[model samples]
Each structure stands twice: as C-alpha cells, then as structure tokens.
Target: MTEGGRRTAEPLPTEMELLADLSRLYKIQPATALWRAVEIREVLKAGLPTGRGLDLGCGDGALTGMILRYAGERPELDGLDYDHGEVRVAERRGVYRRTFCSGSEDMPLEDSSVDFVFSNSVLEHLTHLDATIAECARIIRPGGNLIATVPAPAFQTLLKAQGRTGAAREAYVTTMNARLAHKNYLDAAGWAALLSKHGFAGCSATPYFNRAQVERWEKLSAMTAGVLQKLGATNALLYRMQRLTRSDDRSAGGLLETNRGIARWSRHWARIVAGGVLDNPGTDDRYGCLLVSARKP
Candidate 1:
C-alpha cells in the first residue's frame, strides 16, 4: 500500500470514504463532524473502549454508529442524552443496547457501572461542565477511561479571522462562540487539568482538525447546512434525512436511488474539497480540536 514510508500513491484515506458515507445520512449536519469522525478514529487507535461502553451525549446514534463502524470496533454500548426527544430517536437505531434520557449533570446510571465514557464534541457545550465531569468520574468504574473531544484554542482563531484585528477580531470571536454555543476555548492543558481535578489520572490530549481543514469545513458548511441552521430548521431536516437511512434498512435490494446518487456525489465532493489538504496531519503548530482521554481513579 506504500511505495515508501509515506502514502503518496495509495488509495484515498478512510477519512474520504467516511466523509462520503456521512454525506448520505448527515447531509444537513455541518460537514465538520464528518471530517472529525476520521480524526477521532485516528486518535483512538491507541485504545478504543471495551466492555460496557457509554456514549455520553449521544445525539441520534448516527454519528456514533458511523465512527464505530469505521473503527471496526463494536462493544456493547449505552447512550445518554439530555433531550428525551433526541434519545427517543437514538433508541430506535439499536446501536446502543440501552439509552437514557437525562441531563449530563445528573445522569441516571448506577455508580461505577461503565468501563468507558465516550463523549464527542459534547463537554464544551455543557453549562455545568464541572458537574458533568464529576458525574462521568462517578459513573465510570475505577481505572475506566473518559474519552472526549473538544474544540481547541485555534477554534477561536480560525483561518477566517485572517484580516480582522483589535475590536473586530474580538467581535468575530464572540460571534463564532455564540453560534457554536461555546463559552470558552480549552486547549489540551486546560482539559487535562480539569480531568485531573475530577480525580482522573494520566490525562492526555491529542490535537486534530488542522487549520486548512477547518477552513474547508466552514466553506462546505455554508453550502450544505448553514441556511437550514440559520432558519432553525436543523431538527426538522435531521428527521427527514434520518428517515432515509431507516427506509434503506427495510428495503430489500439495496440503497434507494436517491441515496445512491447522494453517495456518489458525496464521494466526488470529497475528492474536490479535499484535493489540496488531504494529507494526514501528523503534527501541527495549530489545530482546531483536541482529543482528550483520562482514566478515572
């Protein structure tokens, strides 16, 4: 698969394939999440959760299903979501053996019941982040891991802020934060400290989503889901798109023509959109996301 140590002329990375796959089911979602699934997969290559895993903040179970499917790892999973409405939808996917509808600050689970808690891009949005972290600490068995991914410092300084300065820059950051429902950006150090304070041990964070990718995602987002998001139609759109996936499952032969066409275009879209910046980000001076993990102790 490699002429040299580098992957110069090999098949396109799984990330591209994943991007296309997500395009089918999550067309209305920000494309950034599709890009993130692969990076998260890469980050967790060291060790994925095993035995009694929990999908903390699992939305509709779609993203979690795609991520785990690509990772080729399927452990019995439980899901928890703040919205009872969303949890109802997630329960139908059968990805999670059990689903709980509850707030993160007060999860409904027995103490020390799960082996690992996997939260993807969820912690930063929690208003009671400390309390939620404490709950994660409490529910995870001793030595179990809390694996999460959150925005990094570069999220505030996205390449979109290239020309802005002074007050303008601050305003742009504020607007971006408000759009994302984020209170503050937390780099690897901040997350490590928080996990440690919550009695987690050997905390480590790996940064991903390089600057160029974030910029590309921003552009793709405007073309894909930006308008729906602006019109507050995201939930309704998600319902419709999710129906297509469910319908495909019940069909006899294969994916419907609609889904097939979407899949093809999505693959082509991946090719063009990722043409220049498709290289794997081995290291970066700047990145937009952090993959943080720590063991409860």
Candidate 2:
C-alpha cells in the first residue's frame, strides 16, 4: 500500500470510471448508492451526538460523504486511507474536509480527539489487527463509538475452496493465515475480545444479509461453479464464483428496521460459529458479513 507523502508510478483508475463501473454492476445510480451509504452511517450513529468523526481506511471517501450527510450539519470529518491514489481521488471529489494517506495499522491522529471513528469493509485489509485496534482506542474520546464491518470467515473460506489454481490457492491460503490480511473475518467473540483489550466496552457484532441478494448470489454461484465448470471455462468459472461469493456490506438492509432488527442480530451471532467458534449457535443459513460496534471506556 502507498504511504502518505509519497507518489507511485502505477496509474490509478479515474474516479468517474470506478463510479460508473460500480453503478453498472450494482444496478443502481451512482449518486443513489453514495447517498445510501451515508444513510447507513446515520443509522449506525443513531444515538450519538453529531460531533467530530474520523473515517478509518476511507477508500475514495464515499463513506466520508455519507458521514457528513448523516450528521445533518457538516460536523468535522476526516478520512484516512493507505492508498495515496484513493486519498487523491477523495480530495478531488471534495468529499472529506481532510484526507490523509495513512494505513490503519498506524493512524496519525491525536488521542481522544474524535467523537466517533467509522470504518466499512476496511478492517479486513489491515496487516496489523492489534495495532489498528489500539490506534482506534487511542484516537477515540471516552464514550465515543467505533463502528466497523468485515467479511465473515466462512464466506472467505468458501471462496478460497472454490478457487482452482496453484497460485490462486496460494493467495487464498496466505490471506486466511494472516488475521489482518485480505477479508480478515473475525468471529463475534474475537471481535468482543479485541475491543475489550483495546479499552472498549459493550462490544457487539450484528450479522447482516439480504434474502433477495443472497438468493441472487446463490443462482449466480450455481451457474458459475456448476454449468461453467462443465463448459471448460475454468478461469471464468473461478472468477464468477469468486465474484458471486465475495462480501457485499450493503446487502444487510444498511439500516435496521424494527421487524428485521431481531433477525439481523441473530444472523450476526451465527457468524461466530462460521468464524471458527466451536459452539454452533443461531440460525442464518448464509452469512456474508458481520458488523461490530463498541464504545471507548
């Protein structure tokens, strides 16, 4: 990953291209998807006061914009990412008041300065889980919130199992071995324990999935792994299966509704078993991600 104050020769994709591709693939207007992410942030911080917030690993600042929108008034918001290219894109978009190119393993922020620290689909990519958690604890004020989401381990394991190649297998295995590597999926107990170790309290994990989305993914998975395999499209099959099984954070209803909140909570606990916990509890046949929320004490 590129560090702050450094430039690289690798040409980065234009923000417009990225947004257009994402919009086309997700079947939604780019602006609508962007605003929805903000709405989710508002729901996550429902009880907290509108104050200064930090977005850790804020890729392209989409979530940063969401945070500002959800706050109603433009509360002080800063975004940080390890990729200098992404930081540059965020700056160009004017989504964040301040965008820093820094890794989550080592955030350059003052202690107890921010009221809330939010991350989405970012903890999975860190190379230093403990250090990142410690940094979060160090930067957040007392009683401040830390909201994050990560792919569930079971989902990642399934993806690895579907990959069919020596190199692809190796890459998958490497990711699985490192807790801070790609798609670092942690169980409920593990997340709670990490929060406690880092001076956080009331740590909880909520599982999220969309019935309609999962159903569509299941169909896609069958076509890729089943039909495509017979057609001698090994690489294409793997690609489709991987894409079908990959984590989608937005599918979990974004914001919880009264009737659906209980089901989502149950699914979150189910992920504990999926993450390698011995005791198999809760009932959610297919879980893709988990949301963890805690408070600095």
For lDDT, the strongest prediction is 1
Instruction: Report the C-alpha displacement of residue 17, candidate 2, in angstroms.
Output: 21
| Candidate 1 TM-score, C-alpha based | 0.81
Superposed model 1: Cα runs more than 4 Å off: 1-13, 224-267
Position 64, candidate 1: lDDT: 83
TM-score between candidate 2 and the true structure: 0.58
Q: lDDT for every model?
A: 0.71, 0.56
Against the hidden true structure, what lDDT does model 2 obtain? 0.56
Q: Give the per-residue lDDT of model 2 (tens digit) for 1-297.
A: 221211233333322223333332223122223223322432333422347888888766754553344233455678898876567667766767788898787788898989988787778777688899999999999989898877566554444235456788766445433422364568888899888998899987766533332333333344434454456656444434333321232222223223355334433432221232112223555555576789887
Which residue pairs clash within candidate 2? Answer: 38-66, 207-268
Q: Write candidate 1's Cα lDDT for 209-245 as tens digits.
A: 8877777776776565555656775545644554544
| RMSD in Å for model 2 | 14.6
Q: Estimate each model's TM-score.
A: 0.81, 0.58
